[model samples]
Target: MLRRIDEALINRANQSLLNELEADYAALGDKLARQNIDIEAITRSAADFQIAVPSWGTGTGGTRFARFPGTGEPRNIFEKLEDCAVINELSGCTDSVSPHFPWDKVDDFSELKQTADEYGIKWVSVNSNTFQDQPGQEHSYKYGSLSNTSKEARELAIQHNLDCIGYGQQLGAKSLTVWVGDGSNHPGQQHFQRAFERYLASMEQIYKGLPDDWEMHIEHKMFEPAFYSTIIQDWGSNILAAMQLGPKCKSLVDLGHHAPNTNIEMIVSRLIQFKKLGGFHFNDSKYGDDDLDSGSLHPYQQFLIFNELVDAEYRKEQDFNPAYMLDQSHNVTDPAESLINSAIEVQRSFVKALLVNREALYGYQEDNDALMASLELKNAFNLDVSPILAMARYRKGAAINPLAVYRSSGYRSKMAELRPRDPNATGSGIV
Candidate 1:
């Protein structure tokens, strides 16, 4: 009887979604017809956009000051997978999960792989933790990890990355993401050149250990943990390190990793031009690395980034594919709901970017009409594509109103009942 109610609710929601899609396509089709573009092709491509959810994002996220864990938060990787499944089932966008090592480590990885498979989740990228000290560790990364002046500390960091690659291999993951808190906090605290050299030396060993088909993702942060400087502090540093390391190495752009008002889209364009763009750690920030959900603070900026990406696909034909994974930490909002919403917001930007009339924009550029070209981009952005997103999810057997569905299903309450909170327990990773 309860199953029937669930089915009925889903069916009604899907039908409404289809109606909305029809209306949107009809409207957007008129705009596309001006350029003689095929609307169906746009929808088809939009349907194919998929992003990966971070395992750590499934739990409550906090700042260095304090963390407030939510009810039914996933206590382990298995629990995290269950939460990730809910996001995918609703959004129809996040089909993969990126796991952070040690934080998400599991015994019997084969079992872990099988469990994830059961939930229709695939591993995206495996992130290694070398920023903090581990239990029973011989050395501390208090000052640094790969860039540590201590040879033992550097070696420890290198071994951890290698182990992560091995674990990724078992899960059929083809990438390892490495980010380090290796920098000096005070002026004249350390030698920058020597530190980076040590980091490179440490990275060489990890890069060599990667399987031939695998890629190494180097994430750069402008600051945090290190007040004065970070080893891989910006795109220039990231790309330079990638170039020095070899072909399989690429730069990862975490949206929150840059300084405020940075031209991230330009950086993305440059990276793609160099064919060294590895992937993304999607998030938003008002100031430094806030780790807010993607598209929350700057939807337009997100749209612009997608504009460059879609432009690359349409014009450059670069055979370059950047992995998309969310790296956000939400202190408020239910993690599952936040993830689902973030995924949709990203998809919204994608759909808007797809609507850009490329041929017209090109013509405008050729004619040296900068204003009109900018207008061409804005025209698409102005059009609301909620209906189109609704349509795509409905077609894919996902929820039209994912949040509503989740609430109606009482999944969170059920999770709380089944998995109870641990008041005495604490967790690792970003606050």
Candidate 2:
């Protein structure tokens, strides 16, 4: 039997680090006091921060070239939940999961929900799959799904979204995310206005089907499979579609989905100002949509994005709550380890954002002190809040050093022994 990482193991691990943690935490706390910042409040906020894990993220992800499958790749949604449970148990902040449709679709949603409940997980945004065709589908999404010129294809895509809503209702999810690769490859191949019109028509049906409390998130990518143009190619189109759909719809931001060096934080700010920001699919990239782990290459970018988020919170922006979830594609390293690390990095960013003196930042903005304003942000970002993060985990009964303890658990080796690998498994890689 595969033994899960239990309290005994965590206690043993924490023993060696407790004293060091206390010393570091106290020193940081005293330093924060000098600046009139309450470290305890930040620790509480850190302990309270939550990000939903993508169920498919538990398995090995790939690049456009190839996928080097890991030793214990999850064979199905059941196994994926097991891995997700382990991640949440150790990481402390990721207690919910964002599941993709068709890939995670099971015969019995009741059993699936029960299984997730047993694992202490709630469902978040339910992701729909019209981007790719499933086995024995009536209409092919080869050219497009929502914006397909074929009425049959558009109806099929719309029905699938309604089914996704049904599935989410059963699992208690409050949101649905839709991202379609519906565009052309050659110049003048598609009627831009006509394609968008068709997409809006399809999305209108799905939006009408939403539960009163549910929000429909439309995610946009600069370019992909369709290089010339995509239907909802940027935030402008995304928000336009959302507005046309209704108040239940909004635009979702994926960090890696923009052009290189795009000012994503400004986009986030705009969405927030209009109450059209649905949520986020958190991931980092060096180029475009590399799907690198969060904070891997651009920690400051993540921090800046969070700076906007924290500012919204400080100002009590109405209807400003946004869902946070990690959407990385881990091509290398253990998926679970990468998730824990990313969760910590995200948590670290939020905590550091909290350290930013909002009042001072506001004053700097008002006075046009660009240098001091940049310095204020840099000062907060430069602070190492590791102690606060560790203390939060320790207080919440999570591992002080989650990745270290996860390594000690050997969970992957045990899983590899229990489940045989599938040689023909494929993934949603960039190709």
Candidate 3:
């Protein structure tokens, strides 16, 4: 059994860290010299980036076809917190956890809050699980939950979301996320208008249940359980639903929930423009909802999205802050290591976005110099900002090389011993 990794590997990664920081700082100084921008101010701004980890993601994640469970995977919420603590301790970027209802449901809400606090983990957003039916569920969401034609089924779905909101309030969570797996596989299986009307009607009740300070996030997936079509299928539908639900409702962008080659960052820009961007479920996807690690497949795309986000922040756009959370499953790697690496990857994107020569880009845009504007973004993306990231982690008492530290510590093997592997296991029902 592997014990946790030692401190040497964690400390050794600093050589590259120092080198990267030096090069980045020099480059940033040059860019600032050209435009009179403040490099120090940008570095300070980079220190403020944070994203929440999903509790469900702490466990071993598998595809619909197959799942290979990890040895020390967390079996419950408490164990999940332990994994999250490791992630935060090593990465210094993930300070919160987004919990899924029923999957993370427990009796002692107060105790859960205290436990999380002890681990320096805050509950960011409470996700409602209406995609599948739970034990003793009176209504079946077989066809759909909110969009189901059956009045009883729709009513049950509405109640479940409301209940989730109530749980969020108890847990000191400020937002509720709703992702329903409701759509049709075969043609003529459901009516479009009536189904959407039912969904809207059900959502209205859930909206009313939200506390004054709470925001409701509607997550839309193009297709999944229903291969043909899905309600809340695109950003347009998501925004329309949010508009109907009023100011408190906003659309959440899950990176894996889109068609291949979709301009997701453009969609993000549009949502920010409308002031209806609630949050994001960050991940990478090759085919459809691959739920792979963030910045693994399309790092440039991630950087581009952050480019738009940093643009909004620079302008001080109203209601510009968007919640961010990891929504990837660990199928092959240690769940803890994957999460820490993913969080750091996300931070890398944010850091790269911060490096974008905003003034130059703005000037190019004003002069209508499309090539220069494109060049400006590419310049920032091309620069490696690893040192700045390492410095931030160092300042926060995290490891310079999080994955190396985790591996040297041998945390996973220790966990395997503590929590014996399950011979016959059940799936997490994510795909």
Candidate 4:
């Protein structure tokens, strides 16, 4: 194993903040007591929360046109896991990684598993990259992949996904996430029903290939690379495909993949009701799939999503387990620092959502008291839960102020020397 952030450095950094942290935590506890909330309970929930980091996100991301590479971006999957380990060390909430294949593919799957084991990291969903084609490719995905008009292209896509499942099994992943950029660019360019039919047929084969213990997650995107329409365009189509495939197949929601002003929480509720909600690709977006940091643009929206999630937990809803992973594309900031901040922001949402008085909210809803119902949600969203989040990290042997400790450790600067940048950024390059 490589040298991690020094324990002494973290201890020193945390010691400076411990006094203030305790004071704030006590004040918050006192405030919550009147509302019948337990600060310790909220802190424990936060400490127990674990969001997986996307391996691709460990590198600097760019817009559709340009990429501004950072000094020490991970050159391969192993290097990416190294950076992911550092993020978990500081944040303490990201114990697993969601890896994308063809991008993260290697000859030795056993070595990858051993490397992750040494770092105490687990694998979440293994993502398939049918959106872009790889080198020496026999088939081009320019028109489409799984839903391509040509049978050969569709078969190639299906095989790639099956191959991803094979790779994931060795890495200890229980799920496969499929997001295809297959759609029509022009209105008359393609027939909608026929295209969807083709997609379902291709997916059926991939579904059949899944191990009995594994699941297949279908991710939908509104638009990008193809503007007119996408096969799995929204939740409606996502669930439809899931239903057609079988029980183990379900929809994976990406926060940035929806149309503007769409009521995502309602969609999440709908998915939960029918027992088809699979997982999430957590990120914030101002426009379309901007891949901004989590909870950056709209913390309230993030909290609202969590509110529904916590409600499901409160109700003891069966089959409610949804894997959470950060899916931002960091362009300017250090990827590790951005990941640390994103994890805390997400944890902040979860912590605050737990503060909601479920009984009060339910009563207000039952009575149809609009104002009180609104206030019930607003009240929980408005509170600052920083102390609880910090306390959780402190108790987990993580940094009290994760970002501060990360900067103090100088991990990035050191990595710049160890993993020098490639002249040509190969994987997911400039697109």
Candidate 5:
């Protein structure tokens, strides 16, 4: 693999931390042994965990107010792959990148795939963007795209999604994720039933273009751009659309796209029950789609979601596999560092979930011991899994402390020299 960070530097950094990390691992293993849990098995599972990085997030993200671009921000898809490579090289968890259309479009997809392969990266779900109009576009998405009452606009949107699938096929991607900002900003502006009908009609055309082995992931958001209501506003609408589409279509859950205090874990369970959970766009949020880093806040909630995922794994539910990807906006920190940290945070949650005493928890639930059931969950959550995560990375030839090694490597400073900033460039208001 072509590693962006120096192997010698990572070796030295790991050597410095190895003794202490080993001690911690031994202690944790002993603790888990008392509970009859093999820490090695959990560590191996952690080593195997992977998540996809959002290509757009390699650049600094912004809000509606302003975008303060970071130094060495990726200017194009190729540069974005370079940054993604660094993330994977250091963290060893993000092996694929989910790309958005037009922003990542290039003339030669074969070359793009080769470049990604050189960096040991692959493509995940290809996302379609009809929320905004591209330069010289015929129709304006200002009204709507897929759900637009205008035939021209709807046709253009459907074509865009079909094109995305075509691009994904060249890049070895197996899924297409569709998230549109098509709805009404005020009451009585759009007829809800009619708008949804149009959306389904448009999606049906796109669905036909999907390859036999491919999936179509529908992502729903509560409200954005269209404040009054969003066509596919919640899981209800998302799953309904998925069911209507067929077996190849499924619902994608973005962690930030929900009302505050919503029982997202229950939503995961319900999706699993119906075998419609396609994947997740992992990120944290205080309110609305803040797009904060993964597990930056309410880590317990992230852990709970993973608990349900692990539970599904244990039960061997039919077609239980779900794709994992990080979708966050780095407005205040280095995007590379933030991605590395977020990957670790997500991996931490997965490992903790693996540690859960499922049999004991089930017994507690069966006995109706609420307090003990809660305690059982808390016990797994509270156990520090840092050693296990570090060990996994170490064994895989990645950094033991990725952030620390990245900082010491001065990679960002070097990239700043290689990739000068473009003062006239506009920001994408998202990551």
Candidate 6:
């Protein structure tokens, strides 16, 4: 594979931190051994853990109010792949990228695949966008798209999803994610039943187009662009639609898509119970879909979600595999830096989750010792896993300190000269 950053720079960066990392890692191993936890096992899990980065997130993201462009942002899909490569090279956790339609559209699939291959990256889920209309388009999704009252608009939306699947097939993507901004501002403006029926009909057509091995992921959001009601507003509606579609259809959870203080971990447990959970779009939020970096605002919440996931893993839950991906917006910081740090934050949560004494926690639950059970979780969360994460990256031939190495390489400034700035560039809003 072609490398965007020099190996020598990474080696130098690691050399500076090597002794310190080794000391910390040995200390951590001894500490974990006291609790009967093998640090090597957790390190292996951390090394193997992977998450897909959103293609659009490589650029500067903005809110509906305004966008402040970042210097040297990717100009197109190829450039985006270049940036994604840098991320994977340093963090070693993001080897795949989830692409959005139209924004990543290209004429030659073969060449696009070749370019991605050179970067040592592959396509994850291909996201379909029917929320907004394209220039010179016949349909206006202002009212709705898949769930539109107009047959023409709905058909157009369906065809777009079908096209996305075709593109995904060529790009070696095995799933298609559909999230539409189709709802009403007024309570009675939309006939709820009929709109959902239309949505089902349209989705059925798209489902039929899925390859034998590919799955269909339906992403649900409560409100945005539509205030009063959204078609697939909650997990209940998401599961219903997934069931209606079939086994290949599953629900995707965006962490920021739910109402404030919702029991997202319980929702994850329930989705795993029924095998309806497909994957997640990982991000942090305080108010609404802020799309802040992963674990930035709610590190504990992120850890708890991973706790449930690791519990499911320990039990060997039936058909419990869920895709992991980061979906966030970088408005103020450099996009590449934010992605690398976010990937590490997520990996930290996974390592910490693995540290949880599940057997003891279960015993506490059986004895109705609520305090002990909560304390069990708290103990694991309190343990620092930074050494494990750094060592994992180091062993994988990646940077021990990804952010530091990236800055030393001067990648952003180099790209700034390579690709001129675009004054009118925009990104997927807030997410």
lDDT tens per residue, model 2, 1-431? 12257778998899899999999999999999999988899999999999999998997788777778889789899889898888887888999999999899999999999988888889999999887778899889998999999999999999999999999999999999999988999999999999999999999999999999999999999898899989988999999888888888999999999999999999999999999999998889888988889999989999999999999999999999899999988877899999999988999899999999989988999999999999999999999999999999998878999988998988899899988887666644556
Per-residue lDDT tens digits for candidate 4, residues 1-431, read 44388878888989999999999999999999999898888888999999999999998998766778898789999999999999998998999999999999999999999999998899989999988879999989999998899999999999999999999999999999999998988989999999999999999999999999999999999988789988988999999999999999989999999988999999999999999999998999998898899999999999999999999999999998998999999988999999999998998899888988999999999999999998998999999988999899999888998888888888889989999887765545456
Go through the candidates in order and give each one's C-alpha lDDT: 0.87, 0.91, 0.85, 0.92, 0.95, 0.93
In terms of lDDT, the poorest run of 10 residues in model 5 is 422-431
Q: Candidate 4 vs candidate 5: which has greater TM-score?
A: 5
lDDT comparison, 2 vs 3, better candidate:
2
**Per-residue accuracy of model 3 over 46-115 as CA lDDT, tens digit each:** 5677899999999888878777787888888988888888888788788899989889999998998888
Model 6, residue 427: displacement in angstroms?
10
Stretches of candidate 2 exceeding 4 Å from the true structure: 1-3, 426-430
Per-structure clash totals for the candidates: 1, 0, 10, 0, 0, 0
Judge candidate 3 against the unseen true structure and give its global Cα lDDT, from 0 to 1. Answer: 0.85
- Greater lDDT among 1 and 4 belongs to 4
Work out the TM-score per prediction: 0.95, 0.98, 0.93, 0.98, 0.99, 0.98
Question: Using lDDT as the measure, what is the rank order of every candidate, best first?
Answer: 5, 6, 4, 2, 1, 3
What's model 1's overall lDDT?
A: 0.87
What is the C-alpha lDDT profile of model 5 across 1-431, one tens digit per residue? 77788999999999999999999999999999999999899889999999999999898889886788989888899999999999999998999999999899999999999999999999999999999899999998999999999999999999999999999999999999999999998899999999999999999999999999999999999999899999999999999999999999999999999999999999999999999999999999999999999999989999999999999999999998899999999999999999999999999999999988899999999999999999999999998999999999999999999999999999999999999998778765542
Badly placed stretches (over 4 Å) of model 5 are 427-431
The stretch of ten residues in a row with the least summed lDDT in candidate 3 is: 1-10
Q: Candidate 1: RMSD over Cα atoms? A: 2.4
lDDT tens digits, residue span 1-431, model 1: 00212556666777766666687768877877786867777777767989999998998888787788889888899889888988888888999999999888878899999988888889988999998787999999998999888889888899999999989988989999999988988999989899889999999999999899999999999988888978999999999999999999999999999889999999999999998999898889999989898888999999999999999888865648899988888898999989999999999999999888788899999999999999998888888788677777777778888888888888888889989887677654452
lDDT of 6 by residue, 1-431 (tens): 89999999999999999999999999999999998989899899999999999999998888887777787889899999999999999999999999999889999989999999988999999999999899999988999999999999999999999999999999999999999999999989999999999999999999999999999999999899899999999999999999999999999999999999999999999999999999999999989888999999999999999999999999999988899999998989999999999999999999899999889999999999999999999999999999999999999989999999999899999999999976555544542
- In candidate 6, what residue range of length 10 has the lowest lDDT sum? 422-431
